[model samples]
Target: MGPVSFKKLLLVFLTGILFMSQSITVKAEAAYLKSKDVTLMNIGTQKVEGKIHLKGDSKQKQIKVLLIKDEEKKWYELPLKEGKFDEEIWLTMGKGKYTAAIMIHEEGRKYSYGPKITVENVGEVNPFLVPVKHVESNDEKIIQLAEKLIEDKTTDREKAKAIYDWVTGNITYDYEKFGKHQEGDYDNTYGALHTLETKKGVCYDYAALTASLGRAVGLQTKVVKGQVSSELYKGYHAWNEIYLADENQWIFLDSTFGVGGKKEYFDKKQSELSHSKQEEL
Candidate 1:
């Protein structure tokens, strides 16, 4: 071919290459944008379920689901498996009108929040009884100790009592934690496992540890907030109650009081102990 014909052919080849590159870039951008927005579908009162659809094959990345109650200004993080999650979103913080909101987080990405949902009359679906951030009930230490305590106990009541006994016997009240709490150290940074390791904690720690152990042994146990007015202690207190499924009743146990060898508090009526139950969960 002549030089002019060859130059023209070269120009045509370059133009074709640029068009192909632009097409590839557009497709790549479209794929990325598609994976960014996730549709979070609210299914029912106790749970929210959703799926994430991506254009490419799935690879492991960090995924988090947050439960935010705007009224109480309380929020919790729910664990997700792979890229999907379907689970209960709130604590068993008793019966009330609660606003539920969800915020999803992926690794290296901004959080995307879903619309606010209202939940009412959450009677006994206590999701907080399960392992959470502060209540590490699924931790190996708590699990092993719980297994040892309730090894041969076949009944739920028996297992629950065993856990209560272990907590009262092994754990001690931490005066230092109390002082720190008074000084505004409110996080209770050391949770169930740390409490087990140290064998000492304040009322909140005691309740958390007891709840952890109780849950590890498969008992419906929850940390309760209330007021205690006794000679030795008279202030806001945290305790626990175990649900006796067979008896169809909740039995209250104060491990903190029991730690001081006050057996009268075990399975005692909330009114009888001069304890006013505020938050049931």
Candidate 2:
């Protein structure tokens, strides 16, 4: 081969190698740019902070993040800019796991990545900030019966069990029965008098009736909205948390489950009770 021809061939080969290397580098950069590394920090006192490091593409203009706390009824969204994002958020710290997702949007396309975190804040009591007043009823017979139950010679546990049993045995689970009346107003199904008279109601009705009766008997009770999940049943459910003076702990008693004649008492630890179900009642 001539020297000139050999030199030309060598130049062509070198040029091809450079082009291939550039192509490989460009592909690697593109893949790296499309994703990000996300770090979530639980900053204590019901606060959360997130750090995102985005490398590669400068075209990624905006990012959206969704944070789902433990038993949160809704997802909270935060907007972010390109390159890197550092944000702090106020969150509810229930005793359980939390999850968050980061979504990148550029040129009308979205990508999401999530990390799950189990937050352990046991032995925390989220006491009701406001005192709930018991609604006064005009029915004297109901009032008398309630007072009598309270005045009856029984231990606190016995009294709580009695009221729990009475509510469960009396009320029947009826979703169709309510038919969209205002909450706590069972005028269609049964008036306060009738509920007290017949001793039957839906979940809310039973809870209300139980609350009323419990209040009459001097027991502090709170009607909480959450789902009940057990070995037998799992779905949106309502139950009550009764404060027992003797035990000094909140006992979870579901009138619905108890009404169904199942003796499943969820005597969970304080940490376990903090995590409500994902659904809101």
Candidate 3:
């Protein structure tokens, strides 16, 4: 082929590629959510923030959000506290296109579909800080409690220790629930505020409560699931791995086992020693 003809063909191909890219970006941005029930605040970013409002006394109703990234799909149900929810949903599947669908939970596994908002993630964020399915890290109560726990404490480590001390001291183990759980008669317990209010819950609850409190106070905290190996306890366990940013260190703690601070599980790499994580999620 002639050089001039070849150059013209190359230019056309590049122009077509650029046009396709621009089209995808436009579609993503255009899908920013707005409806009578659901109002999405931001899109074309790593995470989307939104609010859900259900008219008239819908107690315990939840807004179920489904995030679709390629073939990967995950759902998070945000509770409708007083018939409303203000939630920030993350794009956990990393940088790419995502589709978020909002549905109103009617009953057991029943949901009424709503808008499907498309997102183009153009940013990155700290995962631990973002609230997930069970961890209501951004709740006012959680934030207030975190502030209360970390009061008069300096440094991230100290703040984390204060929160740890509170959980270990205040919350008690739910032996009955644990027994039922082992027998397959009970599902996992609820999240942070519920634990705080009840003051008794199983290991999952303990980990979630710890994560919520830690995240609220600006510490990067994650809930880890595994099986215990210690002679004291030898079954499934949930614990916390917290990042102390200033210290540039990660420490593991188990508040459930550390009831009354009797167990030396706090900041001792207890998760690594006592439990082995299941194959990666």
Candidate 4:
């Protein structure tokens, strides 16, 4: 879109286990591939990996982890920093075999493949709760902040609202990025940490940040890709769907509209919303 989009520690370790308590974490006794630079762990009967540890000493600034899964063979382009990368991943495309490999970005969106591994122990994991290239819910800073915001809140609504209020109140819309988007000058995949650190982003960043925060707090959340019919603007837009356990429902969240002290879009039933949800990006 005339656009944007959005780990850690898990290194916020307690929060992950809190949500995935029923998950079995076994060190599988299978014949696995070994690499001097890559280390994949917690390969048991679980939907999420404890962490995908990689040590790359590449000069390429655009190194990425390429993950492909299932019979659908969907490709998930994950962000990876040079030197050391320790982050959690999920088989969000349902329970199936997955493949992960290193990639060195050549230019544009082209990348060359590097060390590869096939993962086979993932169970049925919720895609919304899983962190991807954009919504990195497993990041430590996001995790710590989510915990801080929802400290005494026992209800999902309260916890989700805490994050909603913080994002809509603190983050300012980046008009400059919008200008560039109209000119089609940049890639629209800036992840959540960029919004958190800079405090400036577009609709995609807003949704990404909300999803990351919601998931970090143990609530299933997703960055919804869709179209908005708003008095202010329209066209391809991004928002959030947060699952509130007590209500047993997923609610719509649009912090972009809620910015500038507005509260109308914070928490509402998904059916009541007029937004057209295309998919979970």
- RMSD of each predicted structure: 9.1, 17.4, 10.4, 17.1
lDDT of 1 at 82: 60
Clashes of each: 0, 1, 0, 5
What lDDT, from 0 to 1, does candidate 3 have? 0.75
> lDDT order of candidates, best first?
3, 4, 1, 2
Quote each prediction's TM-score.
Answer: 0.62, 0.41, 0.73, 0.75
In candidate 1, residue 96 scores what lDDT? 59
Q: Which scores greater on TM-score, model 1 or model 3?
A: 3
The per-residue C-alpha lDDT of model 4 at residue 178 equals 88
Per-residue accuracy of model 2 over 62-168 as CA lDDT, tens digit each: 55555555455333333345645554332334444444455554353445553323333333332221112222232466567666655665666677777776666
Best by TM-score: 4
All models: lDDT? 0.68, 0.51, 0.75, 0.72
Residue 226, candidate 2: alpha-carbon lDDT: 64
Deviation in Å, model 1, residue 228 alpha carbon:
1.2
What does candidate 3's lDDT look like per residue over 25-80, in tens digits? 98876655555366554443444333222222233346767778899888876656
Model 2 regions lying over 4 Å from their true place: 1-139, 178-194, 231-233, 264-281
Residue 22 in candidate 1 has what lDDT? Answer: 100
